[model samples]
Target: MGFKAALSKVFAWYVNRHLNTVRQNAVALQQKTFSNLIHDAKNTAFGTDHHFDKINSYEDFKKHVPVRDYEELRPYIERVVNGEADVMWPGKPAYLAKTSGTTSGVKYIPISKESMPEHIKAARNALLSYIHETGKADFVDGKMIFLQGSPVLAEKHGVQTGRLSGIVAHHVPGYLQKNRLPSYQTNCIDDWEEKVDAIVKETATQDLRLISGIPPWCQMYFDRLSVVSGGKKIKDIFPNFKLYVHGGVNYEPYRARMEESIGFKIDSIETYPASEGFIAFQDSQKEKGLLLMVDAGIFYEFIPSDEYFNDNPTRINLKDVELGKNYALIMNTNAGLWGYSLGDTVKFVSKNPYKIVVSGRIKHYISAFGEHVIGEEVEQALMGVAAEEGVEVIEFTVAPQVAPTTGELPYHEWFVEFGKEPKDPAAFALKVDKALQQKNIYYFDLIEGNILQPLIVRSLKKDTFINYMRSQGKLGGQNKVPRLSNDRKIADELKEFIV
Candidate 1:
């Protein structure tokens, strides 16, 4: 076998070895991982304050470190930014990933030296897991394009600050750099449009095998490639393209359009990597969820989604999570984040493998008029409608349109940007409305009781979502249009570009 093939085989063996250990006894492996975490950082300031040395069990640790979001951990992160050693982790953070989450805007998440290993290892293992499960490793010898953020980083106090993708780009191993497209200089372009133009010029002729990015941004790149290549599908330019790795947004809505741009159906791997850490990735083709990284230097916890807004919420560990229940994720990682609320929700799909599917964001759901709908539900509904109507939905977002006058019931307003507009726009809207009613009982009840007016669909001009994202200065990386919002914050802004 060739050297690349041998390397692929060895990488697969290594990741699968750990995969088998976790599958054998996930709880035991998690317990051991947690033990190492507390013991390793016990001397750190945050660890000492929490008496990590005295913490001998999960119960002991949970009682001492209360659950907190980025806002709650901001003080410690600020201290780390100000050159404080052993603040959260044992030493100063190597970089701070600056993210503007839908709810928690502008968070500086620390990535410590100790945590960097887990981050890099989890990412490598994600690709390795796909190779192991599918027995496809030829991609190793071909070019791979990671549509990531600007690689140019800035300093915040003594710590480097940039988008997570840019920070990760800096650490791309030397060997893989040979196969990676869009040179570091092109990636350093701060303006997204300019970056995409440069990327297309640099990589349009490469023999690309792997492509990875958020669904919307990837769609943008694919569309541009089609336009630049004289209406040629992506597969025509890069026939070796085999795998599309996606995360940060649900791929369902963009699936048809993406496949159309590529000219063929290709294999896909989904991952759930947040700025805080690399969380999970799809491990099996037969299964539909991502395997939790049981030993990735992170101890996990879950709060039932229903109870998440409660004054006092119950936090359950990995062993206690039930199948098919939405739970907001809380994690204690080696990076010194203890019981940190990741602000995302997920549902356990397999106990034996500890696999889960990301459900939605904590604050990205719509609960207006007692109709609670999440990203998964909205995405499913949109996909169902689009499939039935023979339409291709590029992107969409939903918001409540509260009645301006008395005796008028509130209703849902949908902003749809269509790749292939349905033959009948009115009928398309009706189908979408019916799909939601079928998926959500509360929504059905509200419509039946006249508590909500019929759902309204407003078709948007081409490039509406893109323009909106540009206006917000979040045109690339992990930023995405929130699928559902309680209010019209996003909807109001998107109105300017509406058709």
Candidate 2:
């Protein structure tokens, strides 16, 4: 390996060792907290059945309860909105994390006072882990910039209502909180224009060292920062900036563009942050697989990928998990979400129980034309084609659409943004077609007699997809362009730019 690559590997090994030590300490601390929570839940109105009965062992817990989705919890959310007590958890919730789901409109997920600590601890741990990984903990005491959702707290009555981001921001250390760009109680959504303007004005002279948020929003902020600073790169704005923590969705597609825009290779860390809880984070500087926080105010259960649809899905406790297998994630958080199926899939990368990589979202599977293609399958196929062709893909998306033929079946259309134009697009498409046929028999059969035609690859500009998402009001702040679409609506919407 080259000198830099070898150094990176060595540094990763060192950081991994330290990460394990910290994880062990965190687990012990969390286990005590979890035990006390279980004890408390047993005496509460919501826990008449000895709440610990079902959770005696992780395995037992998985077998007795069916996986639950957000739809099933809508009634409980209604209770919170109406100010009912002991619906999901024991007490009146302190705040709600407002989020938008695919099929559902705005949802106010309950976040109790008791559960706020989990959010804080998880978030703090994520930052600490990043510091440990990059060996930059010494430099982290500088001014840190969090490019997050607005600090506006929604209200129901005369009292201020708490949103997750707002609550967290409010509870941050006084020293750090004082340096925040916007106050926690401000109306961020309604006052976005003014807030953005204020942020530009305030940070125009600060020595900002860290940035945290989704890539799209970060890009927007950086664009503003550039404009205000005479098109200077992030290095010019924060020469000591050492880290970039990003989450929400895969940052792979936007990584190149972001780095180019920023004009520096700032160390990037990926995290799995959901309204329910902070799930996983990359602990080492190497940015290898993420380590799941086992003891963070939640009891985690893994339903084996093979058993994801079993009549009774069996749960595997955190202790019994093996390495390199995918699992449908379920969690019982202190926030009153019990046996909640997160609808996200993950796979273990090591035997150490705390580390796993997010494979994909459960509902992200594509069955266009009835081929039943999944996220992993598609990612693998694309990676394989890129490897064989010696090309690097910057971004890609696939959608199912009906071919305009006399009597043709629907097929998958691919849009690929490459770093450099491929030597031959048709040849690359043929290779991908053959790979899909070999990996998926259903796809192969459909392609043999024209039931499904060969894959079509549309070469697109680097920023085409990002611009498309922005045009649809789905870009910037927490929203991401779908990588795979089942119907033609999003596909048709994007075709204008692809062609």
Candidate 3:
């Protein structure tokens, strides 16, 4: 090996050894911490102050306290919003991480001072694990760009209470903070459009080696980068760039677009980030899926995705989880969310507890017409059909819509964006239909001799779907194109421009 390569390898070895040791220690420490916390919570819930009141098991905890969604906690958050001392947790919330749900307009999730370190530690371990895996720690310790959300925290009495990103920025290591774009606090202001514009202008000339964010935002930013740089390849803008870190949604649709925009095959690191905590992240080597931060200040429970929210959901403890089964994740975090189901599903790819693939979201499934099609199944069908027909699908979405046929029922419609038009649209559609039928028998029953017809591949101009999302006030930030819809409304909304 060359000198630099050899040094990189040695450095990776050292880092990995250190990480393994630290992870083992952290896991032990976290287990003890979580055990005590669970006990305290159980005691507190039942009006006791003793630290060890023995609420040890999941069943015991569940029996005493019912599951709660965000709405139930809104009042406590409102107390913080009104500048109360000790709103939810013991101390005043350090910052609020803004997130949105389908029904909730905007939620300001409290970020406590005690839980901040856990987030930082999980993030740090993710980055360090990636570095060790890739043996790329020697690459100038290059600039890490975070394509983050609007940095604005809600104001109480005209004073800015920091957002999570802002708080994190303040605590960033001096070395890393100097290289971050837009600074942390400045980015937290609610005006994301202006912030994105500033980010594009300022970083147009910098040598960014790493970029991390939701896929849609990154794609949009790179598109703007292309225009600002007068059609320069994204690589040209940051020639030393080595990796792109993305998560928050299924990335298959955006992968080709991102590669085409960047003009290179860049390494990607996917993560499972949520307002509750940073759950897991891709290792530096880009091998396998992300490694769950088992040592982070959280205890995990996996309920089978199919059985989630059932009258009696069966949950697998951390030790009993198996490989290759999809499970809805339930987390008990140091941030005060106990037995909270974050609504995302994952499947383990390895027996080692840390490695798993984010299968899809619980809410992103389509079963409107008795066809229970999931995100992974749809992606697989699309990929399979594309492979068989030798076509490249840039982006796609499937929606169950009521087709006004002469004495017929509604069917599922697929809106697809391809690099170019296919030779035989009908044959391509048939292949996808059969694939879906064979891959998922429930879908077959729904389509056989029923109103639900074969899959429709409404090929559109490149970036058409993304443009539609941008037009809908759901792009360029945390918003993304929904992969699967229960009805055809969203697909119909985007159809006018396809032809």
Give the number of the best model, judged by TM-score.
Answer: 1
Q: Tens digits of per-residue lDDT for model 1 on 372-449?
A: 888888888888978987888888999998864566778888899987888987777777788888988998999899
- Write the residue-wise lDDT of candidate 3 on 1-499 in tens digits: 3454455566557757866664455445456656755643443322132222546655665565444566765665676666665334454566667666655677766666666787776666566666666656544355668877655455663334544555565566665676677655547645555667778887888878888888777877888899989999899998888788787887776677688889898877777767777788776463577777666667777888877758787876566677888898887765556656677788988644357888877777888765667888888888777766767777778887665557556766788888755689889888888888887888888778674777767777777876787676665556667788876668878777575
lDDT of 2 by residue, 29-92 (tens): 4456556556556544445533454566444444444567788767666766677676667777
Model 2 residue 48 CA deviation in Å: 4.0
Judging by lDDT against the true structure, name the best candidate: 1
Q: How close is candidate 3 to the true structure, as a TM-score?
A: 0.86
| C-alpha TM-score for every candidate | 0.96, 0.82, 0.86
Query: What are the RMSD figures for all models against the true structure?
Result: 1.8, 5.7, 3.8
lDDT scores for all predictions?
A: 0.86, 0.69, 0.70
Native-to-model Cα distance after best TM-score fit, residue 194 in candidate 1, in Å? 0.6
- Once fitted onto the true fold, the runs of candidate 3 whose alpha carbons sit more than 4 angstroms away are 1-15, 18-33, 39-54, 72-88, 156-167, 183-197, 284-286, 387-390, 403-406, 449-451, 460-467
Which residue segments of model 1 deviate by more than 4 Å? 405-407
